[model samples]
Target: MTTLLEARGLTADRPGDEGPVRVLDSVDLALESGTLTELVGPSGAGKTTLLLALARLLPDARGSLALDGVPAEEIDIPAWRMRVALLPQRPTMFAGTVAENLRVPWRLGVRSAESPPDDTALREALDRAGLSGVALERGATRLSVGQAARVALLRVLLTRPRVLLLDEPDASLDDASAEQVRRFTAEFVSGGGAAVRVSHARSDDAADRRVRLTGGRLEEVGRA
Candidate 1:
């Protein structure tokens, strides 16, 4: 498989009372096309920090980041984020209907060049996310935690990001809903994209690779 994203010597720091605290230490990772990589670590192990840095959302992070062999600095931040999206642990829903929320990505200047998904496509995606009964006109803010998480995932998918930085997507979901998320992730990678999932459950038997972070450092865990 082709290397879709690569990071070397990645580092990040957060302000502490005494001084800047190291959150990520000289980490290196490679995500390939058509693969899912599971990132496991104890809480506060900097797993989320690494994903933020890779998505260029961490201002205190520094290192070499590349996409498809092109240096990250060479790409615009909005463009880079559009290609490499980070879905936060807590799903966020805007104050609007589901259709409006799903269309939010298209409203952004970064997505101005791309056409938004049609209502039919939106409905189809919702169905795939196990939300067929949820009307597109339903208020997004009224969704339950699990429903919101799936909606958030669907929203990101509609943007067609080349890479997915999933932060505990199944944290609030029930067993069935969590399985739906797993299926979506598997399909995403099989369809030529790549993903890095932060998870604690030992349900990543299908992952192409697994890595664990300890005290801000990373080490390989197992192969497919």
Candidate 2:
């Protein structure tokens, strides 16, 4: 498989009361097309920092980041983001109907209408996320925690980015909803996309690789 993203000597830190708090330390990792890499770590292990660094969302991050052999800095922020999106742990929903929330990306014109999924396509995506029978015309704010997470995942899928950076997407989900998320990720990688999931779950579907972090450091790597 071709490498979709790569990082080397990636390091990061944030301000602390006493001084600087080391978050990520000399981390090295790679994400390939058609693969799912699970990132596991204890709390405060800098997993979020690492993902933010890869997404170029961290200003204090230092090191090299590349996408498809191209330096990330060389790619325009907007274009790069379109290709690589970060699905935060906390799903954000606009104050509107579910359909309106999903359509916001298209309405903003940042994403091409011809590329995004149409109404039927959106419903299918929703169904795949265990949101089948969901009324798109209903208020988005009415969705529960798990439903909101799944909806957020579906929304991102509409953009069809090459890579997904998920931060504990199933944290607030039930067993069935979590399984839906797992299946969604599997199908995504099977379809030529890649994903890096930051999860605390003890077990999950077979992953191509497991990147484990300890005390903000790369402790070990478990390969399939």
Candidate 2 colliding pairs, count: 0
| Cα error, candidate 1, residue 163 (Å) | 0.7
List candidate 2 segments past 4 Å from native.
Answer: 112-116
TM-score of each: 0.97, 0.94
Please report, in order, the local distance difference test score of every candidate based on alpha carbons: 0.92, 0.85
- RMSD vs true structure, all candidates: 1.0, 1.5
> Candidate 1 versus the native: TM-score?
0.97
Candidate 2 local distance difference test against the native: 0.85
Q: For residues 161-181, could you state the per-residue lDDT of candidate 2 as single tens digits?
A: 999999998888889988888
Write model 1 residue lDDT over 12-51, tens digit each, in one string.
Answer: 9888899988988999999999999999999888888999
The ten-residue window of minimal lDDT in model 2 covers 108-117
